[model samples]
Target: AKWREPKLDGRITEDLTINELEQYWNPLLFIDNILSETKETQWLMAQRNETGEVYLLERRRIKGVFLETLELNDFPLDVQDLTITVTSERPESEVDIIPDQNEMSAINVQTFVDQQEWKLHEHVEITKRIMKQEYSSSMKSHACLSVTCRAARRPGYFYWNVFLIMFMISSLSFATFAVSPDKAELRLRLSFTLILTSVTFKYVITQSLPKISYLTYMDKYVLMSLAILCIISVWHAIVTLLDPEHIATKYSKPANLFDLYGLQQHKSFLPPDTAVKSTNNTQNETDNFFKEHASLDNGFADNLLAFFLGSEQMEEADQSAESKTSTDNGNLSTSVGDQQNTTVPRLSNECSLDNKMACEEWKRVQIVEQHVFTSFVIIYVIAHAVFIFWLYFDASRRRREMRQKDKDYRDFLRRHQQWQQQSLRQRDMHAILRSSLHT
Candidate 1:
């Protein structure tokens, strides 16, 4: 007769043994979606020790697939729950499914396996359930054991592949804003190309996921990026279509004055747009002023000759000849006041046109370009700062959660050790009491 040991701690019932009641013993255990199976007849040893106790041990390996429900809302940062179920094919009367409590968190991950992309989360949980047979005619319930495993996907790889790509495309779009508005055609082409590239990137990212009904966080992010890029593209078109004449009129500043005479302390502040016109106008005025009154005064004649003929000797000779002519004419300026009133004002008015406002139109264009570029830079910087802040805090929160989980696991292990130590002490005490009672 085969006898079972009582469930009392420290009770010494040494006559327990298993007699080979039958030649073969089989247990019907079923694993769903098994990939491979092997059947080998192995010798089972039931050793009898001096105390008449028997021990039996067995080992086997079976590979199977467990379908899991994946929640990919956060994607690369998402966590998944995997379940492994073991059940007997026969009804409860024939066999009962039992859970091995000691095997909790006993998932054997190979040391050489690539764990970079995925890692175990916390530990495994074991549970038992009665699987009701609703449609079958037998109406028998099978006992089932389930093991729940949690795993988290590593996000660094996807950060480089997906999020990094999106960031680069966004930065490229921002770069287009700095492009000179004068190159309207080129700017438009660049904007269009960037928009197309964003679309292509979105397509590539989506290809990695299934055609699910709901959008994941990655989907929302990609959409937001595309929308921002589209806005930038529209702004590009706006800049391209800006009216040149209107911009010139609106942004052009007062023209700078060119002083050929030391009277006004000639400041050469001419703008870029009016440089050519101012140069031509100044040359013409100098020529006309000298031609009309070349014989007015010896000093003035010398200065004029010097201005035109780049020679000190020629100017001196001209000054001497003019002085002799004035003496011969006997009209050596009746009054200084008359010379000033008749020559200075008329020459000033005739020779000088408004040299300050030469290239008002082109200057305005430049002003508009600077304003647009500045505004774009401000917007880009603000948006970039916000994006970086969000990502930084998000990563920090995830790290905190991971740390909390580790701490909790450590506490659980500490409590389990305490419980095990207490049970061991109780067992030792009970054995001592029973041994004394038997003596």
Candidate 2:
């Protein structure tokens, strides 16, 4: 509100109470989007310049919560705008709310309570627009002014507690490969455990966010980790089903010829009483042969067999062989030679076949597991890199937009100042012409 007070020059009145100010003009201002008004204080002041023109300025300080819609596609990495919109009860034709060109809106960042979770920007944006009345059938619009402040969520907390934990859990699936391929039960158990852990972690993370229909970036990452764990579990089952030793046992028939030769060879090297005892245990030994060899750990079985057959027996057998008559020794030698000639070649051929099959199986399992691990690593790296780049570009775009807005605002202020100066000059010219005519 403006008025002319010829009696006053470069003077200002004290702050007027609400009642006193209501005696004059009022715009009937109120917050449009406020949820609740906590406290409000308003006062008016009158100031007169050297030209005897008085200006009435109304100042209001309000504290309250305002409603804002959030976009959570980026979630923990997103920036949000908090706005306070003010609108007048009077229509736009009667009351127009405009920003003060001389005073730019601002926010005090030091007063923000969520400093650890959000970085509040100091600059405030003021937008003035006409809002159409929804209830009115006529084309009625209200003057609305919105003051907005931006705040960026700090992602470090989520990165450490959620993303890092999920990555570690998914990585545990790769460690399951260290278990032998034949132990599919153990590998699968570990993989499933990782999957469950990931799911539970995701649930905990979701509880901290709003219930939205679409997935957030963090949700996508967790899902990818779970998928990788499931793939690992399936691979474990595949490798176990294709186990070489199990296949060989299933297809190969028992060769009693090798067992008979093995028993005779042990008896031939033992002393008389020891040979009798060995003969007695021969049936039991032959029964356990298939079971032991089926689960053999490559060459470790040979060392285990020698360790079980005591060294004392070997020394006694050596003494008995030295004492034996030449005729008996020659007959024993011929018998052993006959057994070797008949059975050794066949046994060697069968053993070689089993070894070749085992070697091929090992190579196939290694190739597949290596490929899976490498592929998962590559995909994980690429996914994180893409997310990082997206965040960087998004922040850059917002910064550019803010800079452009500031530039435009400055230009508007310059033009407004020029127009005001021109109007004042025209008024002075009119006043001079009037004085000249009166003279």
Candidate 3:
């Protein structure tokens, strides 16, 4: 039941009482501002007295959806202000939509039905506003009661429903970085799966919200998360290109001497063992010839001098003598074979050195890969920390606003209830007096 305090005129007596002969009274009501109306509402009571002072009561069940401009910049942590405006259908000259101060106070936290998605921030606020007439060019001002209900979204619910899934998808994508870049097909497949999972989650989140032109905080967060997944894919692609040779022997022994020696051109440093053996034999033959020819020199002193400081012809004569002696003695061949056997160990040592160098190079490559992974891990951690911290503070700010509004709403409810009880008692007393007079 609603009550309206009517204005009384000075010409009429304030103490005038209604006779028992008149049992009922009806007063005209002019309420044209309500935009969303329900059919369950009906006029039940209208009582009046001689001074034209009227007391009215009506039973109404109002239920309808109101259109509100939602600001989604903050998204999940955003606070929203919803309003229901009641304006007068008539011009200000004819009627004014006066707000009942006492009635407004009666509204409390309990007035708003408990909802899962949003929490009431404060008590409902009522304000009187003057709106211009819509059609007429001569702007006529009409009074309206703007009722504001401030509320905030419960972010925890959204975090679990949407963000939890997104986080999981991003994590799966990051794991792909650990996979060897050599497996390009496998890596690409996993990355695509993770990316698609993120995209699916994005679609789900968007479906829950109204279509809007601007990006919300949730939208930005989701897109950024997907970007992180894409970055992992990109990182792997780069790693693959950087170490293409590594893939061929990814599963082989960590120390690949053959690959290392091949890349460094170890063959260029030494000729074939067969060529080395033939050259060594030729040099030994020339040395023997020089000794034989020296014995036939002008004298021992002359031979020594010629051997130490001789003309180019002295070596040529030595080589010619050696070739002639080799044709005469078959035992010279046995000496050449002995020298070849002695050089075999040196060839084996060179190969061992090459193997050692190759192993060291392989170790260096592994260290480089470790460093790359470590750097990426650090970047990933820092990125997540910043992202999470920002969201935490934003959600906290929304919660603080909601708490303040809720406090105000509770206060309003208490004041309103007290006024309503007092009004009811006064009305009961007035009714008793009228019944006594009639008897």
RMSD of each: 11.9, 10.6, 14.2
Question: How many residue pairs collide in each prediction?
Answer: 3, 0, 5
- Misplaced by over 4 Å in model 2 are 1-18, 135-139, 250-351, 394-439
Cα lDDT of candidate 1 equals: 0.57
Q: Where is model 1 more than 4 Å wrong at Cα?
A: 1-29, 32-60, 88-105, 109-112, 127-143, 245-403
Per-residue lDDT of model 2, residues 1-439, tens digit only: 2333333335455544546545766678888898888999876767655466766667888888889999777777776888888888888888878877545565666899999988776657878888987977776889899888787778889889988898888877889878866577898888888888888888888888899998777787789788878877888888777664454334322222234334333322221122223433533453354344433332322222222222323454344334443445345444333433343333333333323444455557567778877886787678778767875676445645555665676677677778888988999999999899999
Candidate 3 residues lying further than 4 Å off, grouped into runs, are 1-40, 44-60, 93-98, 105-114, 120-122, 136-138, 244-365, 412-439
lDDT of 3 by residue, 58-143 (tens): 54556666767787878888888877776655566755656665455434555667667777655667787677866867688776
Give the Å error, residue 323, model 2.
24
lDDT of 2: 0.63
TM-score of 1: 0.58
Q: For each candidate, give its TM-score against the true structure.
A: 0.58, 0.68, 0.60
Which one wins by lDDT: 2 or 3?
2
Ten contiguous residues minimizing lDDT sum, candidate 3? 266-275
Return the top candidate by lDDT.
2
Candidate 1 lDDT over residue span 203-301, tens digit each: 887888888888775776677678777777776677655644334333432111112233123223233344334555545454455444444655554
> Which stretch of 10 consecutive residues in model 1 shows the poorest summed lDDT?
254-263
